[model samples]
Structure formats: structure tokens, C-alpha cells
Target: MPQHTPDHPTRQILTLDTGVDAVEPGPDQRWSTWPSIAKGQRGPHPHPDWVVTAAAALDTELGVLKTGKEADVFLVERAVPDDPDRAVLLAAKRYRDTDHRQFHRAGTYTEGRRERRSRDQRATQDRHSAWGRSVRATQWADAEFATLCALWEAGAPVPYPVQIDGTELLLEFVGHVDDAGAAVAAPRLAQTRPDTDLLADWFEQVRSAMGVLARLGWAHGDLSPYNVLADGERLVVIDLPQVVDLVANPFGAELLHRDCRNMGAWFAARGLEVDVDALFAEVFAQAW
Candidate 1:
């Protein structure tokens, strides 16, 4: 047992054996030695090349960002040691604990989707089988990853999907660092109160993003202000695990209408002049 200091009695102090005399270390010396990423040089839209290389060298888990019924998001720091420019903050979305997830509604969203192998499809259908459970979980993850890649390629304002490892997804963090040097999460649009002009701007931004989805013949099945992030002046759309193919799904039109209504209601509540039916009509006009 070591002697405890009266001033800081609760903290454990270790006496390290070095070639020189033992000394009381600085406060920060006891903390992690990994270099903090001062700032990333990847810019607003990081290229796929950089995201891939950086994610391969992820070092630490900062903490949990948010919790949801389907998945939990964590803040992760990835870096190449000794290089600040190559480091970045990433959102690690882990789709875990299928027992707690709302997978019962899976059938509705997966109506138009299919498995390439008949055996795999059968396995997914059999809820009693272990293989079936595994397939169902993997299916959810795969769907989101595919949707992210598709939307990103189409030039939508979305988090850059870095990589996917089984049920885990690594994506671009949507917010900036605070004055205290801690990472600050982007608030959901539901939590923000922008002025009249900024409110209109936000509506336009989200409307444009919704237009991109409409043009692709896709509907964000669970679209709502709660899932959309407000990063300063920009609105980044997220939570795409239930994306629907407008041309293939029977309930696609209803889903699209609901999305427009959800967003329109939020803007309208904030005194923004927006018509839900008009927005839906404009979006559908560009559909395939």
C-alpha cells in the first residue's frame, strides 16, 4: 500500500520505477497519452479516399452521442498518430440488441427489397432459427449502408459513410468543436429555434434534400424533425434504416406525403409559410 496525500486522498498515486528519481507526475500525465486532434483538414465534404484511410486507424471511443430504439450512436476519435491533419471525429452507430429494436415493422419497409440467395431469404423469414435472427440484424445494417452510399453519391448533404463492420457503421460527425475544445453534437431540428429568415433558409435546405430523395424515387420512411440534424446553417438528413423505394413499394406515396407533412408542420409551427401538400406535389413531380 502507498501513502495517501491528505489533499487528494481518493485518487490512486502510483510510484513508477525509472532510472532517475521518482517524481509526482503532472495532472494530465495520468490521462491518456494519445494526441488530441486539434482540427481536421478534411473540409466539409471529405473524399472517400481520406475517410477510408482514417477509419482504418481509429483509436478511441469518446463517448455515447445518442440512444434510439433501433440503434445507439457513439462519438469516436480516429487518427494517425503524430498527424493532426489526418485525424477526425466520427459517429460510430452500433445497431445492437435486436431484441429491443422495433424490428416487427421490418416487413413494411422491406416489402420491395429482396435477398440475392433464396436460402438467405428463407433464413431471414424463419424467426425461430439462430441464422434467421443474424440475417435480420445484418439486413438492417446493410440497408442503411447502401442507402447512405446511394444518397451521398447523388450529392445530398449527409454524413459521409466511412465504413461498415458487421452491425457497426462509421460516419462523418455532423457538428463542430465547442469553445471548451469538446466535441458538440449537432442539435436535431426539433430542438432548434431559428429566426424567421433563418427558418425559411432551413426549410429550403431540407426541401432541397427532400427533393434529392424524391428525384431518386426514394422515401425516407421515418422522416421527422427528430432525425434531421441542424449543423449551424445546414440541415443534414439522417436515420435512413427504413428508406423505401417509391416505384417498388406499395405504400411509397403515403410515406412521402407523411415526410412532407412532418417537416411542413415543424416549419409551420415556427411561423414559416409552408404548404405540406404543395411541397409533396413539387417533390413528386421530379420522381421517376
Candidate 2:
């Protein structure tokens, strides 16, 4: 029989008979009651510390953050045992159930992406097969993780990708903790209505961020206010699994044009005099 710990109500502790050794949970175990968060990591950037290491440990699931047609985003917390300060909260996006995903749009979005193997390419195309579903899940996860890293390094407003495990992706959480110790995700730009000054400032940030992407010869395939999170004075872009390649994909130019129009219209609707043509021209000039 197992008993619950007082501090960790959800954890169960098992006691063995006398003269027998008790087996405690190790780093490899992902127990429901394990404490998340480590020590000495109270810095601004709280990314995962163990990505390429085999000595990495399992993390605790906090809760589900959001759901989409292709994936469900959950909150995960990982920390070194007995070290609370080094703990970090991450957005764990799990890609599952390809049948429920809107993969019909995959062909157009993945035009520029190169598959490492023919099997994977075949599997991705055949979404009805088991191997196909598995490959699609991993492919999307890998694409999102890679895009996040690239955009972050390129100084674009996006989340920092920490690690990718099969169909799951660990990314930086783009929200702040409230005064009551509750985690609050930053509202999407669509959910916000800023004043004149703040709105103008936000537009500038959005334009600059988009410029960064254009300079990298990429375009967010799905650019809208709903996927952009407003974190105080900054804007963090999300959902990059469908990022477009400006050179390889024939529809790349169209995607960039659409993105510029979408964002420009958004700002214009708010009474901001934004030049969509100029923005598109600038991006096109920078694209190779």
C-alpha cells in the first residue's frame, strides 16, 4: 500500500517490509507528485538546462494551456530535485491524433521543407497510416522547434524553444506569474485593445518583428493577431510549424504578402495609418 506525502498531496510514498530496501523514484521516473523547479535559475530567461544530455529528468505536468486542430499545448514544470530556484515552467506542445489535425494544408506549407528521408516524406504524405501519423507529429514538432530557435536567434519576437521529444516540444512560457502565485498567459493581440500610444508602439514592434522574419527570408504562414502574444511592452509570436521559406516555396511570396496585409489591416482597423504596400515592398526587397 502507498501513502500520500503531506507536503505533496498528490504524491504516493510506498513503504517496503523490514530488511528490504525501499525503491525511491529516480530522475528517470515521471511521478505525478514530484516537485518541479530547480535552484539558482531565477534569471530572466528560464529555458530548459538539459536538452542534449542523457542525464535529463522527467518533468511534472502543470496543466493544459491551449488546444488547436493540430496540437494541444500544456504547461510543464521541470527542476533539479531539492533545488527550487533552478526551476522553469515550459509550454509542452504535444502533437497527437493526426486524424483530428488539419493536415490538408500541409502540402502547401511544407513545400520548402526538405525531408531527411524518403520514408518520412512518404509517411507525412500518407496521413492515414500509422507511420504517417507518427512522422507528421514529429515533423511538425521539429519544424516548430527549429523555427522558434531560428526566429529567436534572428531577434524576432518568438518563444525560445528548449527541447523536442518525439511529438512533444518544450518551449519558453510567454506569460507572467500573478501576485497570487497563479500563472497567467499573456493575452493575444486579438484579445487586447490598447490606447493610442500603446497601440502605435505595438504596431512598431510588430512591424520590426515582421521585418526580422522577412530579412531571414521566411514568413510565418499563419500570421494574425490571435497567434501573437502581448507581453507588456513586447510581442511574442507563436505557432511557427507552418513557417514558409521565401526561396524554395513558390507560394512564399504570396504568404508574405498575405501576412503583411493581415497585420496592416489589423492596425488600420484600429485607426493607425499603416502602409501595407510599403511594408510588403520592404520585405520583398529583403527576400532572396
Residue 65, candidate 1: C-alpha displacement in angstroms? 0.4
Model 2's alpha-carbon lDDT is: 0.70
Show the colliding residue pairs in model 1. none
- Each model's TM-score, in the order given? 0.81, 0.79
Instruction: Evaluate model 1: give its lDDT.
Output: 0.73
Instruction: Report lDDT (Cα) of residue 47, candidate 2.
Output: 29
Q: Tell me the tens digit of each residue's lDDT in model 2 across 51-133.
A: 21223334656678999878999976655444443455667788866667755687788897888898888787784889887
The residue ranges of model 2 lying beyond 4 angstroms of the native Cα positions read: 1-58
Best lDDT goes to which candidate? 1
Best by TM-score: 1
